[model samples]
Target: MIRAASRRGIRCVFVQGEDVMEQLKELIRYEPGINLEPVPCRCSECNGELRKVEEGEEAILQDKSYVPMAKIGKCDFWVCKTCGRVYWQGSHWRNMRLQLQRLTKSYH
Candidate 1:
């Protein structure tokens, strides 16, 4: 048998998106510091690792105007090494964080 990701230098992992979301809420269901830390680094759009790209590195930004750079902090830039999507934390990110916080708190 063959797998698409096993062709050469590729790798694969299985994730039940909803499953983890549920688990995070379940595992830290009533933890107080749940909101003190930032979310894990992964492509929100594709769940890929967000690699740090130095200046002059090439990347295809899906939307040039919406590079949400200030939502997280300074040096707010990363690229999804798998899908080539660029990201910067901004307003939408704050909203998502708040929602996740609510989820973690509501478990009590």
Candidate 2:
């Protein structure tokens, strides 16, 4: 799932495959004045931090306006130090969340 991408001065690996597989391969444009930040989280494969991406910059979409958010996954999935892959909620996350809710239900 490690796709090639660069952020700031750090060369990062992004997760590949899934809904928008092609999007993962797309590189984000860095603006000279933009302030980017690295997404701190565990990689789906190896639980590593995703490479830092310059904030304030936008990803140019074909036949559309600039994409403000990094559509890595649902929420933000960071890359891992080992596997160098990104991870986040795919499609079954809602079911997982519901299970958690059920488990954490309080006594009425």
Candidate 3:
């Protein structure tokens, strides 16, 4: 598959992993310089660029239910202009960071 893509002037990577974290590790192993750290620059659901939701601009969200009401004014928010999906660094964000750190240490 990779060879076929290469013939067509495209680059491809074959990643082997049972889950997302493992897949990320494999990607890093394939390319040591790749940045695995989370960045809110793009939407996870779609490849759309994300725009930071400024304070008082929360009303732009089409689906408010995706966000916790209590966190509205407490944390930074990013919205996908194409899909209108909201993103925030909630509790799971810490766990993801920890996992990335472990993955990085294993490689370095």
Candidate 4:
């Protein structure tokens, strides 16, 4: 589905004056679903349970500003409690989503 969106060039744009970091943070917030559960620092990719290393750390966004709130980074990917596989916000997220949006728009 994501790849399909990319082929059609569908893109997501933030509202005017909406900071990308804030938007990204909102997207990164947790939502409950069958495959996901709010758990302690656990690596999403490796499935290795994580231990809290820090309460939160600041993240720098592409717009050259820090995210308003502290974000957690995992030492390893799989079980990093801060983020799981289903939803991850990183440097590449925007670019990757833009391409994928095109692929997704085909159905729309």
Q: Pick the candidate with the highest TM-score.
A: 3
Return the candidate ranking by TM-score, descending: 3, 1, 2, 4
Give the 10-residue window scoring lowest on summed lDDT in candidate 1: 64-73
Task: Write the residue-wise lDDT of candidate 4 on 1-108 in tens digits.
Answer: 445656789543333337653443433332111122233344646655565333333222212233322333533122244442223354465565664444334323
Model 2, residue 9: what's the lDDT? 50
**Global fold similarity of model 4 (TM-score):** 0.25
Off by over 4 Å in 3: 1-18, 61-63
For each candidate in the order shown, give its overall lDDT on alpha carbons: 0.60, 0.38, 0.82, 0.38
Predicted candidate 2 versus true structure: per-residue lDDT over 18-37, tens digit per residue: 64323222222222222222
User: Which predicted model would earn the best lDDT?
Assistant: 3
Alpha-carbon shift of residue 79 in model 4 (angstroms): 7.2
Tell me the RMSD of model 3 versus the true structure. 4.1
What lDDT would candidate 1 get against the real structure?
A: 0.60
Ranking 3 against 4 by lDDT, winner: 3
Task: Write the residue-wise lDDT of candidate 1 on 71-97 in tens digits.
Answer: 333555677878867776566668767
For the record, the alpha-carbon RMSD of candidate 1 to the native fold, in angstroms, is 7.1
Candidate 2 similarity to native, TM-score: 0.34
TM for every model, in the order presented, reads 0.47, 0.34, 0.71, 0.25
Off by over 4 Å in 4: 1-45, 48-79, 82-88
Stretches of model 1 off by over 4 angstroms after superposition: 1-23, 30-36, 55-75, 103-108
Alpha-carbon runs more than 4 Å astray in model 2: 1-44, 47-74, 106-108
